[model samples]
Target: MTDRYAVFGQPIAHSQSPHIHATFGRQEGLALDYRAIEASPGEFLAALEAFAAEGGVGANITAPHKEAAFALCTTLTSRARRAGAVNTLLRKGDRWHGDTTDGIGLVRDLTDRHGLDLRGRRTLLIGAGGSARSVAPALLDAGILELVVVNRTPERADALIDAMGEPGRAITRYWEDIRELGDFELIINATSAGRDRAAEFKLPLSLVNSMTTAVDLNYGEAAIAFTAWARSAGCRNIVDGLGMLVEQAAESFLQWHAVRPQTEAVYTELRTQLAPLAGED
Candidate 1:
């Protein structure tokens, strides 16, 4: 029987997971069925149970559902535990495993693919949400000199830092504390403000320069907000999370099948598909 997998999210119709996975399956010569599943908030649990009942081997959880997926897991990887959220899920004999691969994905894409050295670099992560939480530890582990998290809700930032517990390096700051924070080599937008189509926020122009690289954790229209801000602020390098999206999906594919698919091809294809939305010529 062909193995089955899917990506579950609230508004999953826009998901490129099925396309990415199909490319991976073709590359690896594996027989599988992958799809995008839109599950309402209350339908998440039932969706998982039903998927598992049908022999679904694994699944990827996105947006409004990562935390809920974490809650449903019987076992979680260390990264997932640290993140307090889960993006990838594996079904064992009687239990499910949950893990977050976003950090590794981002790190790999930035360091390996983009040749940006994170070590000894001051990094700014903007958001206290699950995306920031999941990627922060990995950034610290990558040898970033310092990491500061800024959020609209100062308490959420504080909570993230507190949960991180002096893991050697990382600081949390309130919204008002942003101007006091120094400029950084890399700025990461991890908030949903972009996804919600917010026109503006207290994005710090002073904290970025031509040398700084800015990245948004949200893709498509959502990605435009931060990237546009970065460009308007004269930051030369701006990247949306589309590459990270492909990388993270590749990570889940590895976890399920033990084969790391070549991601550049799929990444290129997705980029081509997304170029119009991004206004890429």
Candidate 2:
């Protein structure tokens, strides 16, 4: 029987996981049936149970369900523990195992794909939600010498820092407190603020410079606010989360099928498809 899998989210119609996973399965010659499931907030566990009962080998969790999935997991990878969010779920001997691959995905895209170095670099992250939580531990592990997390809610920033525990080194700042931050080697926008069609968030121009590279964790329509700001601010390189999305799906695919699919081709193909959407935006 073909292994069953899916990506679950509340508003899942917008997810690209199905396409990415289909490419992965085809490339690896795996018998897999992956689809997108629109899960209700309260129905997450029920949906997981139903899918598992139907022989789902694994599934990917998104948005509102990441924390719920983390809470429901029988076991968690170290990264998942640090993230306090679970974006990937594996079915193991009648139990659901939770792990987050977002950080690894971002790091892989940054270092391996983009040829960017993280060691001893100053990194600024501009969100304190699940996306930031999922990527922080991995970014710290990637050898970033310093990281500052700035959020609209200072308490959220503090909570992210506290959840991270004693990082090798990290700091928290409020949006208003970061006026003097500048010349960051890497700046990541992990906020959900861009979801609005008229996103009004603005950054301190000092925080970015010619040397700065910006990454927005939300892709498509949601990334425009930050990426557009990055471009306007004279930042040379700006990346959205699409690559991270595929790379994370690739990791989940590996967990289910034990086959590592070549991501470059799929990435290129996805990028081409995404370009038209970007243009539409």
Candidate 3:
């Protein structure tokens, strides 16, 4: 039987998961079908159960569903436990196993794909949501000296730092104190701020210097806010989340199929495809 796989999340219509997985399967000469499954918050568990019932071997979870997926798992990888979120899932009999590839994906995209040296860099992470939680440990593992997490809700940032269990390396600061934090070698946006068309990122330019790399873990329209702010602040290396998306999909593909497919061909293809859509996005 051909392998059945899917990604589940609300607002999933625009997901590139199906395309990325299809390309990966084709590269490995596998007979597989991947799909984008839309599931609202109330419907997520039921929708996932239905997918698993239909021979689905694995799946990806995004956005608001990561924590939900984490809770639904029978077993989880240590990284997922640390993240308190799940972005990848596997089925075994009637049970689900969960793991998070997001952090490794972001690290690889930055270090391997983008030629970044993450070791010893001082980093600032915006927001304390699941995405921020997902990447924090990985940055520390990659040798970043310190991470300052700032969020609109100070408690969420405090909770994230507390959960990280690295009080010396990870610290929380109020968003209002952003200007006082000084410059960082890296600034990562893990917030949902840009998803709304009317929302704009108003970060202080003083937070970034010419050597700083600014990244938003969101792509397309959701990335506009941080990207606009980064450009205006003269950040030399500005990135959206597209590369991380493909990289993480590759990690999930390897976990399911035992083979890692090359990602640049698909990444370049998607970049070209999206270039024309940039204006509309």
Candidate 4:
């Protein structure tokens, strides 16, 4: 059997990881089996173990599983250790090694692909979930002037800041305090804001300026709500997560296959396929 790989998370049927990896494999002319497996928190470890036992050589973790996957790893890369999360997992014999590519993926997409300067940009991150945790330190390291994190649960936002060990640079605000917060250079929605009719998606437009760049760390249907909100607010640049997704998937592929695949073609194809879905916005 070809080496098997997969992405594991709840509500994962909508994930594009399988397709992204298949594209990467095709570009590299390698035969690989990559699939999306939905697993709840309770069943994640067992599901991972089963996959590893059944020829799974590598996997990507998403959402609620990043932290859990971090805990389950036999070893971790420094990036994974600092982020307190893991989104990429590699099985070596019986040991699973973990790393996080989210921050790098996000930064590259925003900079290399989107042509934005991260230095001195005041950024507002709108969620404190696993994806947020995975990307926060990266944003800070990318030379943002400041990072303000807000979540519906203040303590969680505070915890995320505390975890970053950048008390001087990263701060937390209550969701209600967003109005008082001044405009930001960058606004990132790292939550599942569009998947449900979450009140959190309804944000104050005062937070943006003519040059503000709005980014929803979600793509497709899950991105519609926040992207719509960003558009109505008149942000200068609005981006969904597809580019970040491709960038991160490429990083994960490099780890698993020791080779990098071209991303522009894959990203373009996926973007075209998702064009019809844009009508949802």
Candidate 5:
């Protein structure tokens, strides 16, 4: 029988997961099937249980369901534990193992695809939500000189720094004080502020310079505002989350199939497909 896998999310019609995974399976010569399952809010657990009952061995959770998926896990990898969220799930016998590969995905995209050196770089992460939490430890492990987290909610940012267990290396600042926080070599927007066109958030132009790399953990329409701001602010390297999306999916695929897929081809193809929709020329 072919191995079964899927990605779960609400409003999932636009997901490229099925295509990405199918391409990966073909590259590795593995007989498998992957699809996107739309689960309504408050229906994720039920949807997941039903998938597992049908022999689904693994699945990817996105957006509003990642924390819920973490709650349903029988076991968690260290990364998931640190992130307080789970994006990838692997079933072993009757139990599900949860892990978050988002961080590794972002790191890989930056270092391997973009050729950006992260070692000992001062990095600023905007937001303390699941996206930021998922990538914090990975950034630290990558030898960042300092990791500064700023969020609208100061307490939540403090909590995330506490959980990362590197107080000396990581610190939290209020979003309003971002200008005072000084510039960074890398700045990542981990918040969902860009998801809505009317969502108002302040980004300090002083935080970015010609050499700074600005990344938003969102893609397509959700990333347009930040990307535009970064460019106008003279940031030479502005990247959306498309690469991270593919890289993370690749990591999850590796976890399920024990094989790593080359990401350049899939990423290029997906970018081209999304270009028209995203207003890219």
Candidate 6:
């Protein structure tokens, strides 16, 4: 029997997990089947249980479901516990194990794929949601000089900072004060605001210069506004989250199969597949 896996999210139609995992499975010559399952809010746990009952060996959780999955897991990797979010789920015997590969995914995409060194760079992270929580510590651990978080709700940002152990290297800034903070060598968007087409939440364009690399933790239509804004601001390197998606999926695959698949080919293929959609944006 083939091993079963899936990815779960609320608006899950756009997930590339199944494709990425399928590529990994093929590369590793594993008999696996992966699918995308849309689990609306309040139904994630039920959906997860149903999948497990039907023999799902593992599943990836995204967006609104990460926290719920974390809550439901009987065991968690240290990264997931630190992040307070879970993006990968594995079944051991009858128990579910949770882990988050998002941070490592983003780090690998930026440093390995893009050849960007994050060490000692002054970074600005936008948003204080689960994505931010998952990636902030990883960025700090990558040796960033400072991490400034700006969010609509200052308290949430503070809470995230607190959760990350309130490292002296990290601080929260009010969104309105972003201009005063000046430029950041790297800026990352961890919010879903772009997905909803809300243009009112603008970043300080002056924050981006020819030297800055701007990254949006979203891909396709959801990343257009932020990437376009970065481009308009004279940022030479603006990246969407597709590479991170593929890299993270590879991590999840390793967790389940104990095999690490080469990601360059998969990343290139996915980029080619998304080219038309990117052009449309």
Return the TM-score for each candidate structure.
0.93, 0.93, 0.95, 0.95, 0.92, 0.94
Residue-wise C-alpha lDDT for candidate 1, range 231-269, written one tens digit per residue: 777665777888889899899999999999999988888
**What's the true lDDT of residue 148 in model 5?**
98
The C-alpha lDDT values of all candidates are 0.84, 0.84, 0.89, 0.89, 0.86, 0.85
| Model 3 stretches astray by more than 4 angstroms | 276-281
Name the regions of candidate 4 deviating beyond 4 angstroms.
197-200, 276-281
TM-score ranking from best candidate downward: 3, 4, 6, 1, 2, 5
Candidate 2 at residue 279, lDDT?
Answer: 19
Residue pairs clashing, model 2: none
lDDT of 5 by residue, 1-281 (tens): 45689999876887888999989888999867798999986888889888988889999988868778888898999889988888999998999999999999999988988888899789999988788888899999889999999988999899999989998899998877877998888889998788788765457778976678888888877887887777777776878889999999999999998889999899999888777322121
Ranking by lDDT: 4, 3, 5, 6, 1, 2
Error of 6 at 164 (Å): 1.2
lDDT accuracy of residue 134 in candidate 3: 84
Q: Tell me model 3's lDDT, rounded to 2 decimals.
A: 0.89
Model 2 has a clash total of: 0
lDDT of 4 by residue, 81-115 (tens): 87889999999889999999999999998899778
Write the residue-wise lDDT of candidate 3 on 111-153 in tens digits. Answer: 9888999998899999888889888889989999899999999
> Which of 3 and 6 is ahead in lDDT?
3
Q: Which stretches of candidate 2 lie over 4 Å from their true place?
A: 276-281
